[model samples]
Target: MTGAATGLGLGIAERFVADGCVEVHGLDITPTPDRVVPGLQHRTVDVGDAQEVDDCVEAILTAAGRIDILVCNAAIMQDRHEVLQTPDELVERVLRVNFGGVFNLCRAVGRAMKDAGSGRVVTVSSQVAETPWPGMAVYAASKAAVTTFTRAFALEMAPYGVYVNTILPGTMDTNQMRDSFAGLGRMTGADPESLIAAKRTSMPLGRMGTPQDAANLASWLASDQASFSIGGVFDLTGGELWSRS
Candidate 1:
Protein backbone atom coordinates (compact mmCIF):
# COMPACT_ATOMS: atom_id res chain seq x y z
CA MET A 1 0.00 0.00 0.00
CA THR A 2 1.31 3.46 -0.85
CA GLY A 3 0.56 6.52 1.31
CA ALA A 4 -0.10 4.06 4.13
CA ALA A 5 0.77 6.58 6.82
CA THR A 6 -2.60 8.34 6.95
CA GLY A 7 -6.21 8.74 5.94
CA LEU A 8 -7.56 6.31 3.36
CA GLY A 9 -4.28 4.43 3.03
CA LEU A 10 -4.04 3.83 6.75
CA GLY A 11 -7.64 2.74 6.87
CA ILE A 12 -7.12 0.33 3.99
CA ALA A 13 -3.97 -1.06 5.54
CA GLU A 14 -5.75 -1.54 8.84
CA ARG A 15 -8.54 -3.43 7.14
CA PHE A 16 -6.08 -5.72 5.37
CA VAL A 17 -4.35 -6.48 8.64
CA ALA A 18 -7.70 -7.17 10.22
CA ASP A 19 -8.55 -9.59 7.42
CA GLY A 20 -5.66 -11.84 8.45
CA CYS A 21 -3.04 -10.60 5.98
CA VAL A 22 0.07 -11.95 7.64
CA GLU A 23 2.51 -9.41 6.23
CA VAL A 24 1.32 -5.96 5.25
CA HIS A 25 4.02 -3.60 4.01
CA GLY A 26 3.20 0.10 3.89
CA LEU A 27 5.10 2.73 1.91
CA ASP A 28 4.78 6.47 2.40
CA ILE A 29 6.66 9.76 2.44
CA THR A 30 5.94 10.05 6.15
CA PRO A 31 7.08 7.70 8.86
CA THR A 32 4.72 5.02 10.03
CA PRO A 33 3.13 5.23 13.45
CA ASP A 34 5.01 3.61 16.32
CA ARG A 35 2.19 1.15 16.96
CA VAL A 36 -0.02 -0.77 14.60
CA VAL A 37 -1.38 -4.27 14.29
CA PRO A 38 1.54 -6.69 14.47
CA GLY A 39 3.13 -7.80 11.18
CA LEU A 40 2.55 -4.42 9.60
CA GLN A 41 5.93 -3.14 8.34
CA HIS A 42 6.61 0.38 7.13
CA ARG A 43 8.98 1.28 4.29
CA THR A 44 9.33 5.03 4.06
CA VAL A 45 9.97 6.26 0.49
CA ASP A 46 8.74 8.75 -2.03
CA VAL A 47 6.41 7.02 -4.47
CA GLY A 48 7.04 9.59 -7.17
CA ASP A 49 10.67 8.52 -7.34
CA ALA A 50 10.86 5.63 -9.76
CA GLN A 51 14.22 4.39 -8.49
CA GLU A 52 12.96 4.31 -4.94
CA VAL A 53 9.78 2.57 -5.97
CA ASP A 54 11.79 -0.03 -7.86
CA ASP A 55 14.06 -0.68 -4.89
CA CYS A 56 11.13 -0.95 -2.51
CA VAL A 57 9.35 -3.46 -4.71
CA GLU A 58 12.50 -5.48 -5.09
CA ALA A 59 12.96 -5.56 -1.33
CA ILE A 60 9.36 -6.66 -0.80
CA LEU A 61 9.71 -9.41 -3.39
CA THR A 62 12.91 -10.66 -1.81
CA ALA A 63 11.31 -10.62 1.61
CA ALA A 64 7.82 -11.90 0.85
CA GLY A 65 8.74 -14.29 -2.01
CA ARG A 66 5.68 -13.26 -4.09
CA ILE A 67 3.41 -10.28 -4.52
CA ASP A 68 -0.29 -11.03 -4.26
CA ILE A 69 -2.14 -7.73 -4.01
CA LEU A 70 -0.85 -4.23 -4.76
CA VAL A 71 -2.66 -1.02 -3.87
CA CYS A 72 -1.49 2.34 -5.23
CA ASN A 73 -3.12 4.93 -2.98
CA ALA A 74 -0.65 7.79 -2.94
CA ALA A 75 -2.02 11.05 -4.33
CA ILE A 76 -2.08 14.81 -3.72
CA MET A 77 -4.65 17.52 -4.45
CA GLN A 78 -4.03 21.27 -4.75
CA ASP A 79 -6.97 23.68 -5.01
CA ARG A 80 -5.50 27.17 -5.28
CA HIS A 81 -5.51 27.63 -9.03
CA GLU A 82 -7.71 27.32 -12.08
CA VAL A 83 -6.19 26.43 -15.46
CA LEU A 84 -5.14 29.96 -16.35
CA GLN A 85 -3.68 30.84 -12.97
CA THR A 86 -2.01 27.44 -12.60
CA PRO A 87 1.77 27.28 -12.82
CA ASP A 88 3.43 24.75 -15.10
CA GLU A 89 5.48 23.50 -12.16
CA LEU A 90 2.42 23.04 -9.98
CA VAL A 91 0.62 21.01 -12.62
CA GLU A 92 3.71 18.90 -13.23
CA ARG A 93 4.20 18.32 -9.52
CA VAL A 94 0.62 17.19 -9.01
CA LEU A 95 0.74 14.94 -12.05
CA ARG A 96 4.13 13.63 -11.03
CA VAL A 97 2.94 12.63 -7.60
CA ASN A 98 -0.70 11.76 -8.16
CA PHE A 99 -0.42 10.00 -11.48
CA GLY A 100 3.27 9.26 -11.79
CA GLY A 101 3.28 7.50 -8.45
CA VAL A 102 0.69 5.06 -9.70
CA PHE A 103 2.53 4.72 -12.99
CA ASN A 104 5.82 3.88 -11.34
CA LEU A 105 4.41 1.41 -8.85
CA CYS A 106 2.17 -0.28 -11.36
CA ARG A 107 4.97 -0.76 -13.86
CA ALA A 108 7.30 -2.12 -11.21
CA VAL A 109 4.99 -4.43 -9.27
CA GLY A 110 2.80 -5.06 -12.26
CA ARG A 111 5.67 -6.65 -14.11
CA ALA A 112 6.10 -9.09 -11.24
CA MET A 113 2.41 -9.89 -11.15
CA LYS A 114 2.30 -10.38 -14.90
CA ASP A 115 5.28 -12.70 -14.72
CA ALA A 116 3.69 -14.67 -11.90
CA GLY A 117 0.45 -14.88 -13.93
CA SER A 118 -1.80 -13.48 -11.19
CA GLY A 119 -2.29 -10.47 -8.93
CA ARG A 120 -4.78 -7.85 -7.89
CA VAL A 121 -4.13 -4.08 -8.23
CA VAL A 122 -6.61 -1.68 -6.72
CA THR A 123 -5.91 2.00 -7.37
CA VAL A 124 -7.54 4.83 -5.41
CA SER A 125 -9.10 7.41 -7.67
CA SER A 126 -11.60 10.19 -6.89
CA GLN A 127 -15.18 11.02 -7.81
CA VAL A 128 -13.93 14.35 -9.16
CA ALA A 129 -12.52 12.38 -12.06
CA GLU A 130 -16.10 12.45 -13.38
CA THR A 131 -17.78 15.20 -11.35
CA PRO A 132 -16.18 18.59 -11.77
CA TRP A 133 -15.59 21.07 -8.99
CA PRO A 134 -14.31 24.63 -9.31
CA GLY A 135 -10.60 25.18 -8.60
CA MET A 136 -9.72 21.48 -8.58
CA ALA A 137 -9.32 21.18 -12.33
CA VAL A 138 -5.78 19.90 -12.32
CA TYR A 139 -6.33 17.37 -9.56
CA ALA A 140 -9.48 16.13 -11.23
CA ALA A 141 -7.72 15.89 -14.56
CA SER A 142 -4.94 13.79 -13.11
CA LYS A 143 -7.47 11.40 -11.60
CA ALA A 144 -9.27 11.25 -14.90
CA ALA A 145 -6.01 10.27 -16.50
CA VAL A 146 -5.53 7.62 -13.81
CA THR A 147 -9.00 6.17 -14.32
CA THR A 148 -8.48 5.82 -18.05
CA PHE A 149 -4.98 4.42 -17.68
CA THR A 150 -6.27 1.98 -15.08
CA ARG A 151 -8.71 0.51 -17.57
CA ALA A 152 -6.01 0.13 -20.20
CA PHE A 153 -3.64 -1.44 -17.69
CA ALA A 154 -6.34 -3.90 -16.68
CA LEU A 155 -6.78 -5.08 -20.24
CA GLU A 156 -3.08 -5.67 -20.71
CA MET A 157 -2.78 -7.52 -17.39
CA ALA A 158 -5.95 -9.56 -17.86
CA PRO A 159 -4.35 -11.98 -20.29
CA TYR A 160 -2.05 -13.00 -17.44
CA GLY A 161 -5.03 -13.47 -15.08
CA VAL A 162 -4.11 -10.37 -13.08
CA TYR A 163 -7.08 -8.21 -12.18
CA VAL A 164 -6.67 -4.45 -12.10
CA ASN A 165 -9.40 -2.04 -11.01
CA THR A 166 -9.74 1.57 -9.98
CA ILE A 167 -11.69 2.63 -6.90
CA LEU A 168 -13.31 6.07 -7.29
CA PRO A 169 -13.73 7.56 -3.83
CA GLY A 170 -15.96 10.54 -3.20
CA THR A 171 -15.82 13.18 -0.53
CA MET A 172 -14.75 11.86 2.83
CA ASP A 173 -13.57 13.51 6.05
CA THR A 174 -9.95 12.97 5.26
CA ASN A 175 -7.38 15.35 6.72
CA GLN A 176 -6.18 16.19 3.20
CA MET A 177 -9.72 16.94 2.06
CA ARG A 178 -10.35 19.19 5.05
CA ASP A 179 -7.16 21.13 4.46
CA SER A 180 -7.70 21.61 0.72
CA PHE A 181 -11.36 22.55 0.98
CA ALA A 182 -10.75 24.80 3.96
CA GLY A 183 -8.67 27.04 1.74
CA LEU A 184 -11.32 26.77 -0.94
CA GLY A 185 -13.92 27.94 1.57
CA ARG A 186 -11.95 31.06 2.37
CA MET A 187 -11.69 32.02 -1.27
CA THR A 188 -15.32 31.25 -2.15
CA GLY A 189 -16.80 32.99 0.93
CA ALA A 190 -18.38 29.72 2.01
CA ASP A 191 -17.79 28.75 5.59
CA PRO A 192 -15.76 25.56 5.61
CA GLU A 193 -17.84 23.93 8.27
CA SER A 194 -21.09 24.81 6.54
CA LEU A 195 -19.78 23.58 3.23
CA ILE A 196 -18.83 20.28 4.81
CA ALA A 197 -22.16 20.09 6.65
CA ALA A 198 -24.02 20.81 3.44
CA LYS A 199 -22.13 18.09 1.66
CA ARG A 200 -22.97 15.57 4.35
CA THR A 201 -26.62 16.55 4.28
CA SER A 202 -26.69 16.18 0.51
CA MET A 203 -25.31 12.69 0.55
CA PRO A 204 -28.02 10.01 0.54
CA LEU A 205 -26.49 8.59 3.67
CA GLY A 206 -26.90 11.97 5.36
CA ARG A 207 -23.27 11.79 6.47
CA MET A 208 -19.76 12.21 5.20
CA GLY A 209 -17.89 8.95 4.68
CA THR A 210 -15.11 7.67 6.89
CA PRO A 211 -11.73 6.25 5.92
CA GLN A 212 -13.03 2.87 6.96
CA ASP A 213 -15.80 3.16 4.40
CA ALA A 214 -13.28 3.30 1.55
CA ALA A 215 -11.18 0.64 3.26
CA ASN A 216 -14.12 -1.75 3.35
CA LEU A 217 -14.65 -1.34 -0.37
CA ALA A 218 -10.96 -1.91 -1.00
CA SER A 219 -10.94 -5.05 1.13
CA TRP A 220 -13.82 -6.47 -0.88
CA LEU A 221 -12.03 -5.71 -4.13
CA ALA A 222 -8.88 -7.40 -2.88
CA SER A 223 -10.62 -10.64 -2.04
CA ASP A 224 -11.28 -13.57 -4.37
CA GLN A 225 -14.88 -12.36 -4.67
CA ALA A 226 -13.68 -9.64 -7.04
CA SER A 227 -11.41 -11.91 -9.07
CA PHE A 228 -13.42 -11.83 -12.24
CA SER A 229 -14.02 -8.09 -12.01
CA ILE A 230 -11.27 -6.31 -13.94
CA GLY A 231 -10.96 -3.17 -16.05
CA GLY A 232 -13.72 -1.74 -13.80
CA VAL A 233 -14.14 1.37 -11.72
CA PHE A 234 -15.91 0.80 -8.40
CA ASP A 235 -17.54 3.85 -6.89
CA LEU A 236 -17.11 4.40 -3.17
CA THR A 237 -18.74 7.78 -3.28
CA GLY A 238 -21.34 7.56 -0.52
CA GLY A 239 -24.02 8.11 -3.17
CA GLU A 240 -22.45 11.42 -4.06
CA LEU A 241 -22.09 10.36 -7.67
CA TRP A 242 -25.78 9.45 -7.88
CA SER A 243 -27.07 12.58 -6.10
CA ARG A 244 -29.89 14.14 -8.06
CA SER A 245 -30.69 17.73 -8.84
Candidate 2:
Protein backbone atom coordinates (compact mmCIF):
# COMPACT_ATOMS: atom_id res chain seq x y z
CA MET A 1 0.00 0.00 0.00
CA THR A 2 1.56 3.28 -1.14
CA GLY A 3 0.60 6.63 0.43
CA ALA A 4 -0.36 4.71 3.56
CA ALA A 5 0.90 7.46 5.87
CA THR A 6 -2.31 9.46 5.49
CA GLY A 7 -5.81 9.75 4.06
CA LEU A 8 -7.33 6.89 2.10
CA GLY A 9 -4.19 4.77 2.03
CA LEU A 10 -3.89 5.09 5.79
CA GLY A 11 -7.51 4.07 6.15
CA ILE A 12 -6.96 0.96 4.04
CA ALA A 13 -3.83 0.04 5.95
CA GLU A 14 -5.66 0.42 9.22
CA ARG A 15 -8.56 -1.68 7.97
CA PHE A 16 -6.38 -4.53 6.72
CA VAL A 17 -4.26 -4.63 9.89
CA ALA A 18 -7.30 -4.58 12.16
CA ASP A 19 -8.04 -8.15 11.08
CA GLY A 20 -5.09 -9.35 13.24
CA CYS A 21 -4.61 -12.32 10.95
CA VAL A 22 -2.93 -10.17 8.31
CA GLU A 23 0.47 -8.56 8.49
CA VAL A 24 0.45 -5.41 6.39
CA HIS A 25 3.62 -3.80 5.10
CA GLY A 26 2.40 -0.29 4.35
CA LEU A 27 4.52 1.79 1.98
CA ASP A 28 4.82 5.55 1.77
CA ILE A 29 7.39 8.22 1.21
CA THR A 30 6.92 9.42 4.79
CA PRO A 31 9.89 8.50 6.97
CA THR A 32 7.59 8.26 9.98
CA PRO A 33 3.85 7.73 10.19
CA ASP A 34 1.69 8.39 13.22
CA ARG A 35 -0.82 5.61 12.55
CA VAL A 36 1.02 2.84 14.36
CA VAL A 37 -0.75 -0.43 15.15
CA PRO A 38 0.01 -4.04 16.07
CA GLY A 39 0.03 -5.78 12.69
CA LEU A 40 1.10 -2.90 10.45
CA GLN A 41 4.66 -2.06 9.50
CA HIS A 42 5.20 1.29 7.86
CA ARG A 43 7.89 1.28 5.18
CA THR A 44 9.52 4.33 3.64
CA VAL A 45 9.44 3.99 -0.12
CA ASP A 46 9.20 6.21 -3.16
CA VAL A 47 7.08 4.07 -5.47
CA GLY A 48 7.82 6.17 -8.56
CA ASP A 49 11.48 5.21 -8.91
CA ALA A 50 11.85 1.86 -10.71
CA GLN A 51 15.12 0.82 -9.08
CA GLU A 52 13.91 1.90 -5.68
CA VAL A 53 10.69 -0.02 -6.20
CA ASP A 54 12.54 -3.13 -7.38
CA ASP A 55 14.89 -3.01 -4.43
CA CYS A 56 12.04 -2.57 -2.00
CA VAL A 57 10.14 -5.47 -3.58
CA GLU A 58 13.21 -7.67 -3.35
CA ALA A 59 13.67 -6.79 0.30
CA ILE A 60 10.03 -7.60 1.05
CA LEU A 61 10.27 -10.91 -0.81
CA THR A 62 13.37 -11.83 1.15
CA ALA A 63 11.69 -11.07 4.45
CA ALA A 64 8.07 -12.11 3.86
CA GLY A 65 8.78 -14.96 1.41
CA ARG A 66 5.83 -13.86 -0.74
CA ILE A 67 3.30 -11.05 -0.92
CA ASP A 68 -0.35 -12.03 -1.15
CA ILE A 69 -1.84 -8.63 -1.80
CA LEU A 70 -0.50 -5.36 -3.21
CA VAL A 71 -2.35 -2.05 -3.05
CA CYS A 72 -1.00 0.80 -5.20
CA ASN A 73 -2.41 4.07 -3.85
CA ALA A 74 0.57 6.41 -3.85
CA ALA A 75 -0.19 9.52 -5.90
CA ILE A 76 0.32 13.28 -5.97
CA MET A 77 -2.25 15.72 -7.28
CA GLN A 78 -1.14 18.32 -9.80
CA ASP A 79 -1.46 21.86 -8.49
CA ARG A 80 -4.56 23.23 -10.19
CA HIS A 81 -4.02 24.96 -13.52
CA GLU A 82 -5.35 25.13 -17.07
CA VAL A 83 -3.67 22.78 -19.49
CA LEU A 84 -1.85 25.67 -21.16
CA GLN A 85 -0.89 27.15 -17.78
CA THR A 86 0.36 23.83 -16.35
CA PRO A 87 4.11 23.51 -16.15
CA ASP A 88 5.81 20.75 -18.09
CA GLU A 89 7.86 19.92 -15.02
CA LEU A 90 4.70 19.60 -12.92
CA VAL A 91 3.24 17.23 -15.49
CA GLU A 92 6.38 15.10 -15.46
CA ARG A 93 6.50 14.97 -11.67
CA VAL A 94 2.84 14.02 -11.39
CA LEU A 95 3.17 11.35 -14.09
CA ARG A 96 6.24 9.91 -12.42
CA VAL A 97 4.43 9.40 -9.13
CA ASN A 98 0.87 8.75 -10.24
CA PHE A 99 1.33 6.57 -13.33
CA GLY A 100 4.98 5.55 -13.23
CA GLY A 101 4.68 4.48 -9.60
CA VAL A 102 1.92 2.08 -10.52
CA PHE A 103 3.96 0.83 -13.44
CA ASN A 104 7.04 0.19 -11.37
CA LEU A 105 5.26 -1.43 -8.43
CA CYS A 106 3.11 -3.62 -10.69
CA ARG A 107 6.12 -4.75 -12.71
CA ALA A 108 8.11 -5.68 -9.64
CA VAL A 109 5.30 -7.09 -7.55
CA GLY A 110 3.33 -8.53 -10.45
CA ARG A 111 6.33 -10.54 -11.50
CA ALA A 112 6.52 -12.04 -8.03
CA MET A 113 2.79 -12.68 -7.94
CA LYS A 114 3.01 -14.44 -11.28
CA ASP A 115 5.67 -16.75 -9.96
CA ALA A 116 3.64 -17.50 -6.84
CA GLY A 117 0.61 -18.22 -9.05
CA SER A 118 -1.78 -16.45 -6.71
CA GLY A 119 -2.21 -12.83 -5.57
CA ARG A 120 -4.35 -9.72 -5.74
CA VAL A 121 -3.35 -6.26 -6.99
CA VAL A 122 -5.53 -3.23 -6.48
CA THR A 123 -4.93 0.35 -7.65
CA VAL A 124 -6.69 3.49 -6.45
CA SER A 125 -7.41 5.87 -9.25
CA SER A 126 -9.74 8.91 -9.20
CA GLN A 127 -13.23 9.33 -10.70
CA VAL A 128 -12.06 12.53 -12.35
CA ALA A 129 -10.38 10.45 -15.01
CA GLU A 130 -13.61 10.15 -16.94
CA THR A 131 -15.48 13.26 -15.82
CA PRO A 132 -12.86 15.96 -16.14
CA TRP A 133 -13.11 19.45 -14.77
CA PRO A 134 -10.90 22.23 -16.11
CA GLY A 135 -8.00 22.33 -13.65
CA MET A 136 -7.41 18.61 -13.24
CA ALA A 137 -6.18 17.87 -16.73
CA VAL A 138 -2.91 16.26 -15.81
CA TYR A 139 -4.31 14.42 -12.83
CA ALA A 140 -7.22 13.08 -14.85
CA ALA A 141 -5.01 12.00 -17.71
CA SER A 142 -2.69 10.15 -15.38
CA LYS A 143 -5.55 8.27 -13.72
CA ALA A 144 -7.03 7.42 -17.10
CA ALA A 145 -3.74 5.86 -18.00
CA VAL A 146 -3.76 3.95 -14.72
CA THR A 147 -7.23 2.59 -15.40
CA THR A 148 -6.15 1.39 -18.80
CA PHE A 149 -2.86 0.01 -17.58
CA THR A 150 -4.39 -1.87 -14.68
CA ARG A 151 -6.88 -3.57 -16.97
CA ALA A 152 -4.18 -4.59 -19.41
CA PHE A 153 -1.91 -5.76 -16.63
CA ALA A 154 -4.76 -7.77 -15.23
CA LEU A 155 -5.11 -9.53 -18.53
CA GLU A 156 -1.45 -10.35 -18.57
CA MET A 157 -1.34 -11.55 -14.96
CA ALA A 158 -4.65 -13.43 -15.00
CA PRO A 159 -3.06 -16.39 -16.76
CA TYR A 160 -0.63 -16.66 -13.85
CA GLY A 161 -3.40 -16.39 -11.19
CA VAL A 162 -2.69 -12.74 -10.31
CA TYR A 163 -5.91 -10.75 -10.21
CA VAL A 164 -5.54 -7.03 -10.91
CA ASN A 165 -8.31 -4.50 -10.35
CA THR A 166 -8.87 -0.75 -10.13
CA ILE A 167 -10.90 1.35 -7.70
CA LEU A 168 -12.06 4.75 -8.92
CA PRO A 169 -13.00 6.81 -5.93
CA GLY A 170 -15.09 9.94 -5.97
CA THR A 171 -14.62 13.19 -4.06
CA MET A 172 -13.35 11.97 -0.73
CA ASP A 173 -13.05 14.18 2.32
CA THR A 174 -9.27 14.27 2.63
CA ASN A 175 -6.29 16.58 2.47
CA GLN A 176 -5.79 15.75 -1.20
CA MET A 177 -9.39 16.65 -2.00
CA ARG A 178 -9.10 19.83 0.04
CA ASP A 179 -5.95 20.74 -1.85
CA SER A 180 -7.89 20.22 -5.04
CA PHE A 181 -10.60 22.55 -3.77
CA ALA A 182 -7.96 25.19 -2.99
CA GLY A 183 -6.55 24.74 -6.46
CA LEU A 184 -10.03 25.19 -7.87
CA GLY A 185 -10.32 28.39 -5.88
CA ARG A 186 -7.14 29.65 -7.48
CA MET A 187 -8.42 28.63 -10.90
CA THR A 188 -11.91 30.10 -10.63
CA GLY A 189 -11.56 32.68 -7.81
CA ALA A 190 -14.34 31.04 -5.77
CA ASP A 191 -13.88 30.57 -2.01
CA PRO A 192 -12.52 27.11 -1.37
CA GLU A 193 -14.45 26.65 1.85
CA SER A 194 -17.70 27.46 0.10
CA LEU A 195 -16.84 25.12 -2.70
CA ILE A 196 -15.93 22.33 -0.30
CA ALA A 197 -19.12 22.72 1.68
CA ALA A 198 -21.16 22.89 -1.49
CA LYS A 199 -19.52 19.81 -2.90
CA ARG A 200 -20.20 17.74 0.19
CA THR A 201 -23.85 18.67 0.25
CA SER A 202 -24.25 18.38 -3.51
CA MET A 203 -23.20 14.80 -4.01
CA PRO A 204 -25.99 12.49 -5.11
CA LEU A 205 -25.41 10.33 -2.08
CA GLY A 206 -25.98 13.52 -0.01
CA ARG A 207 -22.36 13.74 1.19
CA MET A 208 -18.80 13.40 0.08
CA GLY A 209 -17.28 9.90 0.21
CA THR A 210 -14.95 8.94 3.02
CA PRO A 211 -11.71 6.99 3.13
CA GLN A 212 -13.61 4.09 4.68
CA ASP A 213 -15.83 3.90 1.63
CA ALA A 214 -12.80 3.41 -0.53
CA ALA A 215 -11.21 1.00 1.96
CA ASN A 216 -14.21 -1.29 2.15
CA LEU A 217 -14.43 -1.61 -1.61
CA ALA A 218 -10.70 -2.08 -2.04
CA SER A 219 -10.60 -4.68 0.72
CA TRP A 220 -13.45 -6.56 -0.90
CA LEU A 221 -11.68 -6.57 -4.23
CA ALA A 222 -8.54 -8.04 -2.69
CA SER A 223 -10.35 -10.83 -0.90
CA ASP A 224 -10.68 -14.45 -1.98
CA GLN A 225 -14.40 -13.88 -2.53
CA ALA A 226 -13.50 -11.59 -5.41
CA SER A 227 -11.95 -14.46 -7.37
CA PHE A 228 -14.29 -14.14 -10.33
CA SER A 229 -13.53 -10.46 -10.86
CA ILE A 230 -10.71 -9.79 -13.32
CA GLY A 231 -9.37 -6.51 -14.61
CA GLY A 232 -12.40 -4.88 -13.04
CA VAL A 233 -12.88 -1.14 -12.47
CA PHE A 234 -15.21 -0.65 -9.54
CA ASP A 235 -16.62 2.87 -9.13
CA LEU A 236 -17.13 4.25 -5.64
CA THR A 237 -18.08 7.73 -6.74
CA GLY A 238 -21.21 8.30 -4.63
CA GLY A 239 -23.44 8.57 -7.73
CA GLU A 240 -21.11 10.76 -9.72
CA LEU A 241 -20.33 9.86 -13.33
CA TRP A 242 -20.70 6.18 -14.11
CA SER A 243 -17.49 4.91 -15.66
CA ARG A 244 -17.47 2.73 -18.78
CA SER A 245 -14.11 1.44 -17.62
Which tens-of-lDDT digit does each residue in 112-217 have in candidate 2? 9989999999998888887888888999999999999999999999999999999988889888999999988988899999999888777887888887988899
How well does model 1 score by local distance difference test?
Answer: 0.87
Clashes of each: 0, 0
Score every model by TM-score: 0.96, 0.96
Q: RMSD to the native, candidate 2?
A: 2.0
Candidate 1 runs further than 4 Å off: none
Displacement of residue 11 (Cα, Å) in model 1 is: 0.7
Error of 1 at 60 (Å): 0.8
The RMSD of every model to the true structure, in order and in angstroms, is 1.5, 2.0
